[model samples]
Target: MRITAENFIKHLKKNREEALQYVIDEYIGIVKAIIYNALKSYNDPQIIEECISDTFLGAYENAKQFKGDKEDFRKWICTIAKYKAITKQRKLSKAPFFYEIDETGNAVKSAEDEYLIKSSTEELLMMMSQLEQLDRDIFTMKYFLNMKNEEIAEHCGLTKAAINNRLYRGKKRLQQIHLGGSMS
Candidate 1:
């Protein structure tokens, strides 16, 4: 039998393997795009692929609880992909850094490089802490997760204009903090 959006949930409940395969074939591109955008800072294909697999696993496991048609399924899977990638990114950020040796026997990621990256990220987070929670969330979603204003607004239950305004204001505040030499 040919599987389609209308019958996807039914298939998922009845034959998970087939439904999963169908979902993989149909929505892999969307999932990959969302995951890639979320984990772009990593620049690691293996991590991205792992997050993709986790997303499909999550969707498959939660299929029984899902409702709505194909469009909703697309959105749902995209959300799964995004959150999974973000979770992985957080774990990686907290994990220890691994270094490689170059052909000339120099560490690819030197101590200075590691210190700069770590300090910069720490400094940015410290600066972000000065903003209101909503503004910080908007900035994280927009810059770190690569979400569009519409997506951020939807997630935050605000209008796109409001999201844009918050982002603008947030940047100005962070700029002031940065310029004032308040970051230590």
Candidate 2:
């Protein structure tokens, strides 16, 4: 039977197993597509899975909000996935581990910790535009795409360990140029 939002909601309201499965089957790909696009620069597999789970959880919790419209449902779920991706991206970007290192070798205020992170987002983008193609690809896959290391390895034809190494080195280089003196 064709799944309509009205029918889906009816079954959902009843808490029927078929209703839940139908929702999953119909919308999981949509959620994944939204998340994958938003996180195309990221390479952590779990983040994608987390976003996917959160997408469904949001849908389930907000089932009552699902108007009997397919487009509306897709938009609602995609919105949730986008928000989740942005939140996750902000959290990753603000990691203290990537904070600036002082001449004394101590971690100073984080490169990502200041108001500039929010304000200088465009600058960050500009810097990314300056990276080599391969570096940009790995960086995008790791941070933007949010794929797993294994997934990136398969996509890029490298070992997971090699992907990790490249990501590590590439990020370090970005930090050095962007967060180091004169850039931030």
Query: How many residue pairs clash in all the candidates, one count each?
Result: 0, 18
lDDT of 2: 0.66
**All models: lDDT?**
0.74, 0.66
TM-score of decoy 2: 0.47
Measure candidate 2: CA RMSD. Answer: 14.2
Clashes, model 2: 18
Model 1: per-residue lDDT, tens digit, 23-80?
9999999889888877878888988999899888877876765665676567656656
Candidate RMSDs in Å, in order, are 11.0, 14.2
After superposing candidate 1 on the true structure, give the runs of residues whose Cα lies further than 4 Å from its correct spot: 97-184
Error of 2 at 140 (Å): 24
